[model samples]
Every structure is written in C-alpha cells, then in structure tokens.
Target: MKETFVILARHGATEWNRISRYQGHLDAPLSEEGLEQSRALAGALAALPIKAVYTSPLSRARICAEMVAAQHGLAVTSLPGLIEICHGEWEGMLLSEVEVRYADLIRQWRTYPYTVRMPKGESLVEVEERSWAALEFMAAAHPGEISLAVTHDTPIRTILRRILNLDQAVFWQIKLDNTGINVLGCRQGRWRVIALNDTCHLGGWLKAGEQMAL
Candidate 1:
C-alpha cells in the first residue's frame, strides 16, 4: 500500500444549526438545506474511486455518509471516535450564552485550551487525541484504499492539526462549513492535505464564517 486517501466530510446542516444551538452530542436530523448539501456532496464525490466508508453515529453525519456510500454500493460503519466532541454542559447552549456564562473560560479556550472546560466537557486534548486515533485506525484498517469519513467540525480540525503537529493557535485559523469535504492522503509515514474546507459543489451554497460556528 503506497498511500491511503481519506475524505473528511462535515455533516450537512442540522435543525439546531438553523436555530443556533450548541449541538455537540445531541443527535439531530439534518434540515432541508442539509439534505440538499448531502446530495450535492454525494454527487461531487461520485467520480472518486472510493472503496470504504466510515461515519459518525450521529444522524446528520450518518445520513450524508449513507448517501455517498450508496453511490459505490458500500456500507458505512459508524465509528464512535468519529463522533463529535462531548460538549458536556455546553451541549445545547448557544454560543452567545456560553460567552456570557463562561466568558473568561471561553476567552481562554480561544487563547489557549490549557485551562478551559465546557462546564464539564472533555478537554481539547482529549478530543484531539481520540479523533487522531480514529484517523490512524481508519488509515490502518483500509490501507491504500480510498475511504471517506463523515463527521463534525471541531473533530476534523483537531485531527488536521494533529497530522500537522501544529501549535494550539492554529485551531482558530481553520474553518469547516456544512457538508464541506476535506481531502487527505496518508503515505510513507506522512499525511498530505489535498484540500481543506472545500464547498464548491453547492456553488457557494454553503454558509461560511460565523455561520460555520455551532
């Protein structure tokens, strides 16, 4: 096996996304726009020679992965590590409310996650470690095979940072939109980022910037 390429797909829009909820671990279905996003994403990936598929157990990610996997007659296996970070107390809080309640903590998270917690959530490192483990496991499980993983935003960012061994501040510099596809290829003990936060399929239909936050 020379290299293994994996496409990281952030699940399409969710109902909470429309209402601006935390949506960390709460399972919610995708909105109508999310469905359209999934369709477009599946169509965009239709040409790729995908061999296997993995998805977060969450409905939104699973749905998107299911549609894409259908194109190649593949079955999606839900990987627990691919699930979103467990936000604990902040699971369903609005970002604005978190800012008001955990003001200093939020600032510290934005600054450095060394001393921040979402009331009772997993630390940033916990998410970073587990998500990378998932990535490593996926690459190993399907060596030299083109695999696709459907998951959430923060986990994807954390995994990317791990692959690059980047500094903590690098987290803020990255952005992932709804139904966005990030392509990565692991080869010869190194990972290559082919694409990041790509949303060309919907023809700019994807919401960006603060709209990407949830």
Candidate 2:
C-alpha cells in the first residue's frame, strides 16, 4: 500500500490568542504577526506536493489554509467538522475569567477533561468523534499523497489524542503552537506520527515577539 502523509497545522495567532482568551467557535481574524506566520508556513510547505488543503469554516483557519494552498494553486475546501471545540458560555472569556467563574469545572477540565463537559458546549469526546471522521474521510480521499488541514487548538489536540491512542483525560498533554506543523503518515491501515508541533519555519517571527502561550 502507498503511504499517505497528512500535514496538520493550527491557524495563526489572533488578538484573542495573544490575550489568552477562549475563541472556541467564535471567529477572530489573524493579527499582523499572524499574517507573517501564515506566510512563513506557506513557504515552508511550498516544496511539498500537497494535493489538497482542508480548513475549518472559521476565518482564522481558512485564511491560513488559503495562504498555503495558494502556493500550490489549490483551493481550500472547508470542513465544518474541523471547526474548533465549542466553548459556548466560555467563548471570548480570558483564561483568568474562566478560572474565576468556573473554577471547579475548569480544574476538572485540566485534571480530568473527559469528565468535564463545557457548559452549553461540546465535549472532548464529541470533538474527537467529528474530527476523526473528517480526518479519516480526508485520508481515504487522498491516499498516497500529501494534504494539509488547517484547524484550531482543541480540535487538533483531540485528533492528536485519538491518533496517539490516548485517553481524552490526557488531552492537555499535547501542545500545538499557532501555525505549527504536525506530520502523520498512514500506510496499510496503520498510522504513525512523523513530527509534532514543528515551528522551525517561524523562528524569525517567534523571536520577534509573536509567541503564543496556548
């Protein structure tokens, strides 16, 4: 069987991201520094033979997918299932604010994520289910080829946890940086992670102060 390579990337930084706010399903445009990060990511993947680019319907992820796909003369295909985990009531709130209002729940989320479902939001299990469906569809559609998927932190983390065969309670252990690249290979029905959260392409901007804590 031919091997398939999937490049998973989180969208670039946003104003909310800089302030440590929960974007969830909310939309936030990329900041000036974010535009640079997208460009750098585009350049980094320019040499690859990316057959398709998938993105969340949200602008933050769509923009980054566009930047990278444009380099290969490909159009980005929006996948709603790839959207960020809905934070619902916690949307737009800073981490500190969430800590104050939902302290116990927040602690549960940190310590036992699978047990703490966000108020009015989807759970990590939901994210994992939908995200895996989307990814499996993409992988099947583009066998033996390279493809890109631009998404958000939680969705990416959920997918990573599933791919690694880990429990959702350990979800926080995976850290994905903005515009970070993760490479996964699938061959003969087996999946292997080749790289995780690679930011070497954005060394210049990261050094210049576009660092993101999440």
Candidate 3:
C-alpha cells in the first residue's frame, strides 16, 4: 500500500474576504494581510518535500500556490475543477444582504447545504463531485509523494467531506481559515484525514477580528 500525502490549503484572504462578501467565482486580489499569510504558509511548508503544487485559476488561490511552490522550486498547475462554487447572484453580496434576500435559502445552506442549490449556481453535490475528481486526479498523479492543492473554501470543504465520508448536511460543521492547511493521507483509494484547518503557521498573525466564508 503506497502512501501519498495531500496537503490542502485555502487561499489567503482577499478584500472581499475582509468585507465578508461572497467571492464564489469572482476574482479578488489578495490583501496585504493575505500576502503576509501566504508568506507564513510558504515558510511553514518549506520543510516539506512537496513534489508538486496545484491551484485554482482564480488569482487568490493561484497567488497562494505560487508563493508556496516558489519555496519548494515547484511550478503550479492550475486546474479548473478546483475553482470555487459559483454563487450566481450572490457573488458580491454580503452575508447580511444574502439573508435579507434569500433568507430561507441561506438558512438551508447553513443547516443543510445539500438541500439547497444557489439560484443560477451549483449544488453541493455538484461541487463535491468535481472536487473529489480533482483530489482523485492528484492522488493518481503523485503516488507515494506529497503534493499541495491550493483552492477556495467551498471546494476545500467538499474535498474534506469526501475524504472523511461525511454527509453533506454536516457541511457547516467545518471551519477553514484563510491559508489554513488540511492534511490527508491516501493509499489505494482510501484516505485518512490527519489534520483539518491547521493555521499554526500563521502564528499570532491570525487576527481575531478577521471574517471567513464558504
């Protein structure tokens, strides 16, 4: 049974992230704090034998991947499957605004994400399928080695759910901070989650007032 280590990281914070706006597929540049966070993450991962790095095409994720890859002298391969779930009309809205317009749907999303689909957007099931496929592709491509996959919140959550074999209804139970790391060990199609939302690398830089979203 050959073992492969998959390190999952959420992209660093963006202005939208600071304002608590829904990023979804919208492109947002990393904030100054975000750059610092990426540097911290890169430093933390410098000791690992990262064979390759993969990222979503979105700038936030791509920037994070590039930072980490540079430390290990690995180029990043962007994969569309790792892009964030499209939030349709909610892409730029704040959570409070979403609550005002789609109260019931927002409730369903927080409580039972699998039961509600975003208007003109994707369902949790759809996100899970594509993200799981991305993970499987990485595992097959880098057997017996360690790889880094940098993506967004929803996609990371979907991958974690699949790796843990958890129901989609439990989606909101997970919390992933900006630049947070999740470790998964895969062998022969089986996975064991070693860590979830590990942000110790951020040191005291993780501000208590910072907001996070999915």
Candidate 4:
C-alpha cells in the first residue's frame, strides 16, 4: 500500500536559535516568534487530511507538533528517533565558541557531515540509522495514511538528504526555515521526497508575542 504524506514540518525557533547556540539536549521553550510560526504552520496544514501526527520529545518540536495536532483534533505521538542529534558537552554552547576551540574538527564535521561527530555529539551515520529505522516503523504502523512528522531541523533535514540520496556534504545547503514543511512519502517499503524545505505557512514575516510559559 502507498502511504501518502501531506506535510512534515520542523519545529519553530527557540531561544537558543537566536543566539546560534548548540541546543543538543538543552530543553527550552519556544520564543514568541516560534509560537506564531507554529500557529501559522498549523493553519497551513488545516486544509489537508492529516491522519496522524508524530513529534520529537523536546519542547520546541513538541510544542510545534501539538499546535498542528490540535488544529486537526489529533493527539501528537512522541517518537524518540525523531529527536535531535545530541550535542553532548556542547549542547548549550555558542557556535562561535565551539568553532574557536574545535576549529579543525568543526570544519571536518561540517564538510563531511555523515561520519563526523562533535566531541560528544552523534555522528551523521548514527542519526541516519536511527531516523531511517523510525521512518520504517511509522510506515508499518500507519499504512496508506497521510500523516505529519514534526521534528527538529537537524534530524528532519538529514532524513530528507538520506531519502533523496543526496551528498552528505550538502546537508546544510538545504536550509529548513522556522516552521518549514518538508514532505516525504512511503510507497511499498521505499521513501520518496515530494518537497524539500517549505515555509508558505508563515505567510509573510511575523512578529512573536511576549514570552509566557504555557
């Protein structure tokens, strides 16, 4: 059976996003703009027949997933495999700081994204292995259903690269804007990329509200 997909969206921005910090495992709430982005994305997917919703466990991804799931009156299912690649010791460090300390390692990691792991982060191969396994799991569980997977930018983007058989070196070249929707599908145990990064949901530039814990 062919599993049709409507949209797969990355979570909105967070506080760490503004500072360009490595939020590997640092769980933080979304900023005002992030919430607006989520609402806008939910509006984008409202016209589609979203059968189910999958989300990463982190706050940023979860919040975004929940927002969209609520629009469809469906509960968001947590998938550990969709979680961000853990950055370990550098979870909350600034990108510039890390670059200064681990210059060569950082360069190699960026250039050869598939094999290099940060000092304590996961390798691209490790992330791909788990993400592909998770995709297979979703495919088996929800056959022929149009669904959504709301996850972190890194993992979602990596999944796109792997499924498209693109060069790992160009992973970052496919930028996933805040609340972007990248679509993929599963037909007969195989995956196909329908769309890369999309952000038409946000309409135009949007300003966020004040930070209030929800």
Q: Which stretches of candidate 3 lie over 4 Å from their true place?
A: 204-212
For model 3, state the Cα shift of residue 65 in Å: 0.5
Candidate 4, position 67, lDDT: 88
Error of 1 at 195 (Å): 0.9
Off by over 4 Å in 4: 204-214
lDDT of 2 at 150: 97
Candidate 3 lDDT over 1-214, as tens digits, reads: 6799989999988888888899899898999988988999999999999999999999999999999999999899999999999998888899889999998888888898888789998988898899989988998999999999999888888888877788878887887889999999987778999988888887633552446444
Which candidate order results from sorting by TM-score in descending order? 3, 2, 1, 4
lDDT of candidate 2 over 1-214, digit per residue (tens)? 8899889999988988888888888888999978989999999999999999999999999999999999999999999989998887888888899989998988888889887678899888898889988888889999999999999888788877877899766777776888999998999878888999898998833553432223
Which is better, 3 or 4, measured by TM-score?
Answer: 3
Give candidate 1's total backbone clashes.
0
Among all windows of 10 consecutive residues in model 4, the one with the lowest summed lDDT is 205-214
Q: Is candidate 2 or candidate 4 better by lDDT?
A: 2
Clashes of each: 0, 0, 0, 0
Model 1, 33: alpha-carbon shift in Å?
0.7
TM-score of 3: 0.95
lDDT of 1: 0.85
The TM-score values for the models, in the order shown, are 0.93, 0.94, 0.95, 0.90
- lDDT, candidate 1, 180-206, per-residue tens: 889999987699899988889878634
If the candidates were sorted by their lDDT against the true structure, best first, what order would they fall in?
Answer: 3, 2, 1, 4
